[model samples]
Target chain A: MKSILRLSVNGKPREDAVADNTLLIDYLRDALGLTGTKQGCDGGECGACTVLVDSRPRLACSTLAHSVAGSEIETIEGLSHAGNLSRLQRAFHEHLGTQCGFCTPGMIMAAEALLRSNPHPQRAQIKAALAGNLCRCTGYVKIIESVAAASATTELSA
Target chain B: MAALSDFRLLRPASAAEAVRLRGEYPASRFIAGGTDLLPNMRRGLVTADAVIDLGRIAELSELRVVDDRLHIGAGVTLATLAADPVARARLPALAQAAAAVAGPTHRAAATLGGNLCLDTRCMYYNQSEPWRDAIDNCMKIAGDTCRVATKSPRCWAAFSGDVAPALLVLGAEVQILGPQGMRNLPLSEFYRDDGMAWLSLAPGELLLSVRVPLADGWLSAYEKLQIRGAIDFPLTGVAVALRRTGDLIGELRIACTGVSSRPELIGGLDALAGKTLDDAALSGIDRQIRRGTQPMETTVISVAYRRRATPVLAKRLAKRLWAASA
Candidate 1:
């Protein structure tokens, strides 16, 4: 039941033979040794396993590894370039968005998708995009602030 | 943490081929987005020896308006359907319901077909396998007794799909393909009251598309009562469609979910025809809904709370539709 899967991960081509039931999160964390994507609440309820598949945010835990073959998959490990944090990541840190740090990776990915589609999203829009992700700590005040700050930074850069 | 059982994955090029593969492997399950099925598989609620992925089939992902009806392929993702211009302009109720399902990331992967045919859920039935086994199981699984209503002879798992009630209220029809051939039926006919056999889909049968007719001069609204704004199934879902002329009601259809095993299309609304939806008439409809629905003790909240919320949600949604039509 093992099939060869060929996909682009973190802007690099990856090919591996995987079981039919291999989840995308498992393939990323175990087979590829990219542990930046944390797995919490293996069910689709929690957004801890969020990843970008074909430039869209999706729950990695509920996604099958074989179904997304040949798609560009982005993970937390790919957020920084040349060892410097991405704009969204820097904004998250500066705004004190991480508390306990378990939900940061997924939170950033969800925001990344929102910002990619809407450069200067309003507060309600940012909240709607991150509605699926759960952060028990920080009470979501600073998380929203971080996304708003990231949008402002993008405007300045532009 | 649960893990999926071993299974062979099959990718068919077309719907006909998918049916053929399904016929060849009777124990296989068709997976489009895997948002609902995979988690159930992991929890040992659904057992399948093979998975037939419908994502690669191009024809099944089509969403178009033909003549006067909107034809949405079963494989169309919920996110795509919610954001489609035609759906938003023509079927706003369906668009809102689809947008309200699950969360943003799950909406990106969950398909309309899967949401329409979502599994029945219960507090006891949806638990992990070991947890269910420890409690001696329920009628949804292996046990003979119904935990929700100990003396009842059937399973009372709640059908919590947010999209089906809206589709039902819009007077939609489903296109089904199977080993016998293809046939189209009203969306209401596709559901059965029994939770164990909620869907009327035969073995090896595949749902092809959902066809919703465009109705002129009709306005609709949907409301869902749940604990969270996102990522939670509705405890009570209400949908109302009203066609009015000035202050008089021309046509009205009310439907609800999460109150029973299948979405209930409320009857007895014809009594208020040609009459304005006044406070008295609204209270009458609310009482009718309360008397008709039987909320079981299956979810986190108490049965009384869910039963009480049903009529409130219906009245609120009815008022919204009336205001919009006015």
Candidate 2:
């Protein structure tokens, strides 16, 4: 069945009519043309498809489009404004967070969520928050550094 | 490819409404989180026209304590159930089991109801129908003689719900609401010994909630015997609950999960009442568990390894319970 989902993406009201079985990842990439969110291990293993649903990081591939019908969703493409990247997004580039770029969107979204609730998180807390995400190529040394750097940067700005 | 995009999805308000809708569309499957259902649907393990999402059902999403029991709605996520203060304080076994299911992301999405009613899994049968047919099918899907037990008449698939064993020790009751109205029965009575027909639930019937009697003066814990620390299903999971007084065990309930099609409770093994958890006592319990289990070749891990680990799990669980009680 065709279901029209009305959701607040980033900071705007976005509505899309999708099939009942339309996966949220595909809906974001195809319907909305937001391909920044990479799809890896659509079975919800690798956190490559992670996106913020109501400020909580969730796997977009495993989530159905119909399920998120009156909820707020945030994708990587919408994380930035006009022509500038978010602080967390830039921190990844500076901290060597993105090696293959497959897990960047998810890593950034997870870090963004952590910093939203906690601008200054301990190293152990940051690691726990990113436990679900997998970065096989980098061994997660840089990703952890990226989140820590973002937290420190957020702390400095505050 | 064109999707099956013409079916209407109904959002029921309560268990009663869910039952009513089940009556209306007897073919529609009730969806709570869809962690299990969606994957099974993609594999064509279950076929359904409409997905009646129960996520919006307000009455089915709560975790409450009533009188002497902890009631967990079917829609309660594993993550929430693991962190529920009342459940954590009263029934630590259940909380521990919930925490060990899948992973953080999976726990956030997998619901307690779905975990309890998890589909019976066999290495061969859990695959796609086409994949099964390619091998001339196994006993669970098509062909007659059991591949695992060979001469056995029935299939030997494993029932592997991480939270079930803990709840079994807690002596929980299941609240199942269906087209025939609602009925609450002891959780132990919910399953049959048969693998293919593990659950006694009727088709279209939805498990609404699970109620566990609070552990009083007793301590419990769940131990998973798997390779990985986070995302691993135990080849043989054990839940042990023992109450001790002075130098004797007051009450002991040791159960096994994934050892059989349905979680098996050792009958005469409960004779551990007032028995001391000495080395000899532990050995006797291990012997009994070894004699009772005898896991077949059906699950992912080797049957020999699982069988060997069963007794080890029993002994370890006994020792842990004894130490905690002491």
Candidate 3:
């Protein structure tokens, strides 16, 4: 059975008639073409498929489309407006937080969620927040530094 | 779109609706975080006709502390528990277990209910069924006679649920809701100590809530021995909950996980009812802890290694408890 699912993805209200078993990642990748949410492991182990559902980063590959009805969705592509990189995105570039960038989208999205709520997070706090998103290339040091560097300025702003 | 077909999903708005839907579709299962379920499905260990998404059920996502008992709903995420100040301050062992489960992102989506219902794990058993068939199937999933315990009739796979020992030592109670209303009992009582029927929840019964008695003057600690400090399942895990009265130990509960078929609790702590946790007492406690564990050839860790490290963890836990109270 299929039902219509309505939600605002990346701040825009959208609706789609989804089948009973359609995953939210398929809706984002195949239907809406929001390919930024990578589907890695298709299970929840690798955070490569992470996307924000109601401001919390979740495994899009594992989340069903029908369950996200009426919730706010955010993807890595939505992090910036007017073609400008968000601060965390900029920090990733500055700190060399990417290698092949396979896990970049999920890592950045997870970091953005952390920075959104906690602008000034400690080193331990930053490490804790990004634990779900695994980065095989940078060994996590650059990723941690990117968040910490962003946090320094983020704290001063707030 | 002309009604897509991939995997069937149903979002039940309420608990009643979810249970009723579960009744209709015997092949359907509730989706809490999908960390465990989705992985098993992708690996083909589990194939479902339909999946009931439990996110819409508001009653399951609550965390309430009332009258010295903390009530945690099934939907409450590990991230929420790890980040909650009340949990850290009041239920330190649980918070430690929650923080250490998987990694941060998993802690965000993975719920208390999901962790509690984590599939019984083993390195040999977690592989694909086809992969198992190649090996003639281990005792856990497809075939009979535990290769882990080749002489054993029952599955020798581990009960590696991270929070089980933490909740067990804290005097936690599990709430089970079914068609007949609800029932609550000590969390330890919910275990069958058999890998096949690990959780005691009956058909159509949802593990609704966990009630942990508040520790006022009590000091607790949780320690896990794992290959990696982050994201790896514990080779052996320990949780210590104690109440010290002046120089005397008022009460104590020691529990361990990832060491047996279930969260193994070595009771009869009344012996240490008034004894102080000094160097001598800790050494004595370590000996008692060694007597408690009966490690087997299940998990990734060697039985000899886990058995050796069990008392070491007990000594560390004893010292931490001493310092926590100090």
Candidate 4:
């Protein structure tokens, strides 16, 4: 069953024919060619497929593409503007938040949602927001620092 | 990673239409958040000919008070429930339990109805299709023997959900819509001890909303024990609701999940009323919980650990609620 899904991706409205059973991650990675969103554990165990649906972080692998019709879906690729990395991405890069970079996109997306809502989040709040996302490489010290650094930079700019 | 099995998806606009579609496709299953169902479907633990998505139903997303009782629609997401001011002020246990489920992202999508109707999970049953096939499916699936308890005819899959215990302690009632009509059942009666048939919902029935009587002067709290603080299901989850009458116990209710096939309200607590929650009373309550809960080898955690920890967790919650009343 294929239906036209009308949604906003990366601030652009898209109306694509998607299968009823096609997961959001597949639709982004395969259909839209947004390979920035990596699929770590296809099952909902790992947060490698985290994306922001209507400004809230959701597991793309667990969500159906058609289910999020008329919503704003943002992937990791949406973060950069004019080829420059977003604040969180730059923080991750500078703070050594990525090793293999498998979980970086989902981690940054989850943190992106967190920082948007709570611009000055504490370490515990940052940790709580990204608890679902797992990073095998950084041991979370750099990841936490990355999020904290992004928020601190935001504070400095404000 | 395994792919999801092909199935038709139907989105209904209303609860009545959802029921009609369910009847139209008798082999269909209701999906609210798809957090639990999608994972299970991907693992081949469950399959439906069609999935009747309840996401678009407007009525199921409402959360309001009716006649002094909080009418929480089944479709209300856990994240919304956790952050709701009314839920936090009135039924803090439910809010805390909702916050405690899975992780922040999962809670953003998982619904109250789905959590209430979560499938019973077992170590052997929750595995991949190839893994389960290698050992021959368990009683929950197609096999003849129960994997957790080989000789037992019934499956021992534990109900590891975190929300049911909180609802049970609050004396909640569920509004169920079926082909016959609408009916209400006590939340306690909504579960069965049998793992394979945990929920008491009849075929073609949908849980509409949960009605919880507002606890005016009650101090409630929920505690969960899991391997991790997030994502993992509870090894033992306890919810305690207590109302004090000036240094004496006015009312005390305790409920637990992940200790058995169904989340249950701990029994034999009527004697504790009008008595101060002293050390002796707390110890007595601990004994009662230990006697009531029978943790099996359903999860990766040891039965002995769960059995020992259930009482400690329950007692800690009870004491905290009791102390908070002061």
Which candidate model has the greater TM-score, 2 or 3? 3
Off by over 4 Å in 1: A155-158
Which tens-of-lDDT digit does each residue in B1-326 have in candidate 4?
57777788898999999999999998889999999999898888788889999999999999999999999999999999999998899999999999999999999999999999999988999988889899999999878899889999788899989999999999999999999999999999999999999999999999999999996888888989999879999999999999999999998999999998999899999889999988888888888898888889988889999998988888888888877889
lDDT of each: 0.91, 0.79, 0.81, 0.91
lDDT of candidate 3 over A83-147, digit per residue (tens) = 77878788889998887899999988888888888888898878877777777675589889888
Native interface contacts kept by each candidate, as a fraction:
0.95, 0.22, 0.72, 0.76
CA lDDT, candidate 2, residue A104? 86
CA displacement after TM-score superposition, residue B26 of candidate 3 (Å) = 2.4
**Candidate 1's chain A scores what TM-score?**
0.96
Interface RMSD of candidate 1, in Å, is 0.6
Task: Name the docking class for model 3.
Answer: medium
Model 3 lDDT per residue over B9-102, tens place:
8778888888888888888788888778776776766667888889888989889888879989989999898777877998899998888888
For every prediction, compared with the true complex, DockQ reads 0.91, 0.41, 0.54, 0.79
> Model 4 chain B — which ten-residue stretch has the worst lDDT?
B1-10
- lDDT (10s digit) by residue, model 4, range A1-158: 78889999999999998888889999999999999998988888789999999999999999988889999999988888877788998999999999899999999999999999999999999999999998877469999999999998853321
lDDT of 1 at A149: 94
Residues A69-149, model 2: lDDT tens digits: 778888887777767777888878898888978888888887787788788899887876777787869558888887888
Q: Of models 3 and 4, which has the larger lDDT?
A: 4
Indicate whether candidate 1 or candidate 3 has the larger lDDT. 1
Q: How well is each residue in B73-135 modelled by candidate 2, as lDDT tens digits?
A: 988999899989987887888899998886666677789998988887777776765787787
- The CAPRI category of model 4 is medium
Candidate 4 residue pairs that clash: none
